[model samples]
Target: MGNSLSDGLTDAVRRFQWFYTCHVRVPHELVEHSALSLTEMRVLFAVMHGGACTAADISRTLGLDTGYLSRMLTQFERSGLIERRPCSGDARSTQVSLTAAGETGLSAASAHVRDDVSTTLDAMTPGERAQLIASMGYVQRLLSPPADAPQVRLRGPRPGDFGWIVEREAQLAPGGTHTQRERETRTAMVVADYLTAPDPLRNGCWIAEQDGVSVGASLLVDGSAGSARLAALFVEPGVRRSSIARRLIKACVAFATESGYGRVVCATDLNPVSVAPFLRPFGFEELSNQGEWEKHLKEPRAF
Candidate 1:
């Protein structure tokens, strides 16, 4: 019986490994480019996304070894793909920005990768595609970066952001996830409403980044002079733990307080599985037990 149990456990481990390889890992071999290596592609992506960055910052963002990054930097510099300049505040530090050639190369490569992924995804049935995407989403949330991970941020929602926010809300609602067509049209209308709103605080949203990718979002919705509600707080699965949710929460609270709201409130449909722990540390109390949980933020707390 012991031998049989051991065999069963071993088989389970092997299957798990196989599943991880098949579903979770992107095959880097498929990303082959004649002009750029994989490391170069990653560096270029980081520089392009951040607008301006330094070698040290790039290493931190990608969690890459500095030695390896230096080599890549040298190659990119030689190719005239990036320019390095002295950091304004620090003479010893250098800042890197993309050259026009670098930008064009990165864009072309991005388009190629997207086309390849789309082609492959197109081969699946709609239901199969949905399941694959949902499963990946679940894994993404599970593997989200830790709270103290480096974050990149922008101040608030820009002109085309309402649509992005709507799409985010729909994606996060599980069963209520919207289709691409629904996302495009309905999100456009939602954006229009936000755009027309008189108050800046009423129609604003923030996206949190980890490893140079947008991982989660929070929104400040209409409220009276000194109060606002935190709405549509959602984080992508793989990057959930990295304190992005907390940062987003704090952003909403700060926005409320600065915009003349004395306090901010948040409501969560309590799921023992996913909702409670993140709130407890931020002065969130067990306001009710009827399957809904609420928290009010009156002051900032160190996260």
Candidate 2:
């Protein structure tokens, strides 16, 4: 399977290379072209849109070799294609911008690719465009893994995300030989049922994905007569301190409140980490019982 995946990816890249190269790599195709190499045009484009960009910014965003970009900038400056000035705060580096000539060049280069893409897209049917976008999006996510802070966003369930929610929570329940697999399995089933049920009280079922990968989930289900329940809040252990769980709970509670629930309830395990100290900030108060927590709200919050 691994070898097949590798082969498939290689073939896909090979197939995409010709189209990208013909449009981007060959600058001579444009009537009023910059006559720049592919990488140079990319650098120019970066500068054209880069209002306050440094050399390092261009290199990082474009994934260009440092030495190569420096040489290109020097050549562009000599040709009066771009204006470079030392940064005010950091004299060690320089900021870049496209001069009038550079803007004309960027316009030409952009037009060449833009028209080609428009024509190709216009020729394709809607279904074909969707498939192509999905495929290209897959490739884009694969190539550009998250580099900055891992952003965890809560979105309603897409296809197969419910399964991810189940799988991710199941893998985290085991500790040692005395693992409580049965309890975790039951919990997953209950959550899955709640996810698919068509009750209006079911406020929302949100899955949290970190950098395009599902890492956590939370469910807001019908709890009591006039309240909502926050259920199945979990984040992968490897990604714990990222505040994904907090965001998920917050989003779920907001939805419940906005959906006209007077109060929200949650059940936690008998541990400080689970219920006692963990949910203090979101205005949850521990009940007189063992592991039950509740919050009362006057106004519903918008998600």
Give the TM-score comparing model 2 with the true structure, all chains together: 0.57
Give the clashing residue pairs of candidate 2, or none: none
**Compared to the true structure, candidate 1 yields what TM-score?**
0.44
How do the residues 71-131 of candidate 2 rate in per-residue lDDT, one tens digit apiece?
8899999999988899998889998988888787677667766787788799999879866
Q: Report lDDT per candidate.
A: 0.65, 0.71
State which candidate has the highest TM-score: 2
Best by lDDT: 2
Cα lDDT over the full model 2: 0.71
- TM-scores of the candidates are 0.44, 0.57
What is the lDDT, from 0 to 100, of the residue 165 in candidate 2? 63
RMSD of each: 11.4, 7.6
